[model samples]
Target chain A: MTPAIAVRGLVKRYGRRTVVDNVDLTVMPGRVCGFLGPNGSGKTTTLRLICGLLTPDGGSGTCLGEDLIAGRAAIKRQTGYMTQKFGLYEDLSIRENLEFAGDVHGIADLRARVDAALDRLGLAARQHQLAGALSGGWKQRLALAACVLHAPRLLLLDEPTAGVDPKARRDFWDEIHALAATGITVLVSTHYMDEAERCHEIAYIAYGKLLARGSAAEVIAASGLVAWVATGEGADRLAIRLRDAPGVTAAAAFGASLHVCGPDQAALAAAIAPLRGAPGIVWQEAPATLEDVFIHLMRQVPDNAGQG
Target chain B: MRGTLRRMRAIIRKEVLQLRRDRLTFAMMFGLPIMQLVMFGYAIDNDPKALPTALLAADHGTMPRAIVAALGNTGYFAISHSVTSEAEADALLQRGEVQFVVTIPADFTRRVIRHERAQIAVEADATDPTTTGNALAAVEPAVARALARELTGPLAGLAPRAGPVEVVLHRRYNPEGSTRDNVVPGLLAVILTMTMVMMTALAVTREYERGTMENLLAMPIRPIEVMLGKIAPYIAIGSVQVAVVLVAAKLLFDVPMIGSLALLSAATLLFITVNLAIGFTFSTVARNQLQAMQMSFFFLMPSILLSGFAFPFRGMPGWAQLVGEALPATHFLRVVRAVMLKGAGLADIAAELAALLLLLGLVGALALARYRVTLD
Candidate 1:
């Protein structure tokens, strides 16, 4: 089967500086792809370009078998782009917003479709309430419901859960999985590591460049980052010292332990050897984490993301 | 571009629903016209009456008093003071306390009895020629009537025919000199332009301000579809405003409507569309709601001041008239006045209709061109 999304050499330049620089991407149908990147890393711009919400400065590709520029309107009809902000009218009732979405998509039996969406969201009870009155999590869910109101072929969610609670985020992931089960392709950008792990494959970008593209395990192994877990009473405080040391890409405190990773095992051990037996700390070699690989990748890119 | 009708209908319905919920803005759409009509009706007077005058009756005679009484009876002048010297009259005119200074020159009643060519000098303030010209014209006929009443039996043959030339002055259409007749019809154009353009100009900008424009453009709706959908509801609003002003003009003000109602309705729709198009074009240029409001205000100032609504169109300078000619309000004003007061047919106002159609086309094209299809 053909992939739902396939684009190469996609570049977007705002004046002199590039926002999405020569990015290439391909996602198969029914596969949930997590787009992970630091802030100002061109993730949102890439999603906008793919869904035809934005024009690419330089690219040649197809979205759902339609030319990116020529068939933009046609592709837009079949693709749902849920912006980072709640784009639905705030003053409108939840049901009204859904009905408006359905209407714009020219759905038949719009009333029934909206009612069904409301049922799925468990928002039928408060269907008449204004969307602005809902909490952050509920608002996110309503926005999600509106995106899928027309049963779009592709979903481009930009940070679907930024400020949502833990339980709500889990429910949102469950909904994504269910949609993916039905062969609806998903390309969701997020900063959360747990959400990144739930995706079938991951694409990590930084400073307008795609740094990694593979499954979470594949990306971590591909980074070849060496890591050591230091545990005991004072290991958490060692993160502050190891963070600035040579060959130590990331040294983050996770609960009572310090997870330190670097490019080479020899240099990494050399950086942490002096503190190995100091006080009540135990060191053990561990596999590098997805978070460690991402920090390493972010460090690799220069900090000239937005400059010309 | 496909399914444009469905998407446009959806947008229109959504706009109307939002308008219904926003009671204040909805009220403004209709209230602005009536309020402005009533406010300007009592304030503006093209043919000002009861202009203050100081009469220096140096010729203390029965004939001079009768002439002054007749001027007052014409409803044009009020002789408030009888000054003894020309200096006092000059001071009153200079201080702007009086619009006109009437001086019955120091002559005895002997010149009239001897049948000499006697002259009565009346000085007028020439500032604001419209007010002075109409009031001064009434003076001659009033003096003629007063002199005819005075020269009854003995001095009958001496009654001046003014000259061999006889002129019959006619003030057609508005005989009562009612300012409301001009104002009420002009209100239709002014109000439609104010409300239609500003409301729609704010509509698209409001979408952008609230960040919903991205979501909207990401749908199947095209730029033209969005423009038409945003303007459709205001057309109905413009119609309602016209109805209210027309009914009030007939019932409350007793303004005459000498033309066909059908022609007026058609012309009004065209004018309203022109304004909506201009407003939609403004929305494409403005980035936020505040900027939209400022742009609408900038457009509205010239439309009201130069559109022949506040002042006579012909009285303005040639270049200013050129600016007025380019405005939709100027043509709308002419069309409405011709149809409502002059009893003009569609053929009589064809030029104005053509102007409105051209404006609609040009502004509509500009709006379409400026509107962005993608977020880029």
Candidate 2:
């Protein structure tokens, strides 16, 4: 079967500056695709284009087997988009907001659907509470419940867990995976590296350019970055010296240890060999972690790489 | 279309419930009309009586006494002062203590006996044109009666021909009119028009500013459906305001509806729809609620001034009258005053009804076309 969402040379411009430059992407059903990008990148804009919220300036794509331009209304019918902000009525109760969403979708038996949504999201106990009174975690859950209440074919979430707690973020991701297991395509944009790692595949973008795209292991392997993890009394002092030295592109402190990454293996070894013999410091070569490779990739791109 | 209907119904239900929760908006919606009705009803009085005036009689004789008694009996002016000199009356006028100063000349009895035309100097403050006009008119009958009675009695043989002065109270439309009777009914339109336009204009724009409109627009709904949904509840509220204002008019100011109540309600309903449509159009275009409110006020100030609520529509200049005709409030107020006071029928009010309906259609279409369903 064709991929659930397939697009080629997609371009969206705002005035003279292109917000989403020429790009190609394909995602199959039942896969959780994490779109990672720095601030002002085109991840949200690309998602909006696919979800029919915006019309692209150039390109042709098929979303859910419909033409992206001509069939936007049809695509919107089966797509659920969760915005960054909490967009429900604060003066209304949880049950009322859910029912309102259900009615907006024109679902028959709206009360039953709302009740089922409440139960599925574990929100039954707080059904009568006003949406404004709910905690951040509960509000996140409510937003997710409203998004999925119609049983959409694809879900687009933009920074869904930016301010949410760690435990709540984990639970939200777990629910997302469960939804994907049922063949619902999920396109989620997030700032969290851990959340990106949890996805089946990831696309990293910066300055409106897609720099890297693949599974975490594939991206790390493709980056070809070698790293060494070091710990000791003077790791901070050592990190400061190693940052300016040759073959070291990214030098970061992870907790008490220093993670030094570079692309050239021979040069990396020669550069760190002197540091291993330094006093009050221990150094050893290690597999470059996703974050280590991720940082290395970000540093490699020129400052204006995505300007065109 | 069916989905749009469902969504609009849901939006209407939610908005109505939210309005019920906000106590301040609720109070303003219901209380403003009654307060304005009562305040304006009591404060407005067109035909003023018992104006205080001073008297300066040079001769303490029967003729002076007759003149004072005649002025007092007219009930239009009260003799608040009996001065010995013209200087005293001038002092009263300068101090603003008296609106009018009446001076009877020292040769008052001699002039009448000689059958000559004696003129009494009636000095009055013209700052308040209405009071000055009334006071000026009242002097005629009082002086005339005093002259006629004196000539027919003790000065009958001395004066051969003596005629009374004429006092004509010029009232244009509402002759023999009570001010409450005219103003209370006119205020019904003013109060409802102001609040209704403001409330409806802010309704949708507020949702847009609060970000709740994203949830509303994300649904599979058409723009017209959203517009209707937002305006329907405000229309219902406006009807209740109409009823309250009309009832207050009847009870407090004794305002009678010479025309059919059904006609008034029908015209008011149409006007409310037009006003709400204009507001919703403004809401759709405004970036924020504050801008929407400012736009509403911009529309409101001119509408109130030119709509003939406080000022006379016919008295306005040609360009001003044309501008007034452009406002929906102008036509609606005309319909209201005609139906409520003149007992005008459908045949008499077809032109105004047509104007309001045309405005409603234009605004409704414009609102739908301008309203965007997505953030883009």
Maximum-TM-score candidate? 1
Query: Which residue runs of candidate 1 sit more than 4 Å off their true CA positions?
Result: B55-60, B81-133, B152-158
CA deviation > 4 Å runs, candidate 2: A244-246, A267-274, A292-308, B59-76, B79-95, B145-150, B154-173
Q: Please write out the lDDT profile of model 1 over residues B1-376, one tens digit for every residue.
A: 5578888988999999889988999889878987987886667778888988888887878988888899999898988777888888899888888888888766736677788766777888888788798889888889889989998799998786667887786878887777889888898878888898899999989999999998998888878788888999999988999999899888888888999999999999999899999999999999998999999999999999999998889989999999999999999999999999999998999999999999888988898999998888
Per-model TM-score, in order, reads 0.94, 0.92
lDDT for predicted candidate 1 compared with the true structure: 0.90
Query: Using alpha carbons, what is the TM-score of model 2?
Result: 0.92
Interface RMSD of each: 0.9, 1.6
Q: What range of 10 consecutive residues in model 1 chain B has the weakest lDDT sum? A: B104-113
Candidate 2, residues B1-376: lDDT per residue as tens digits? 6777788898899889889988999999889887877777887665577777888777656876787788778776787887888788889999989988878788877676676766577788778877677657767767767766766755677533444875576964456667776777777667666777778778888887887776565556677777788888998998898888788878867777889999888988999888888888888778887998898889888887898877779999999999999898889888877887788999899999999999888988898788776667
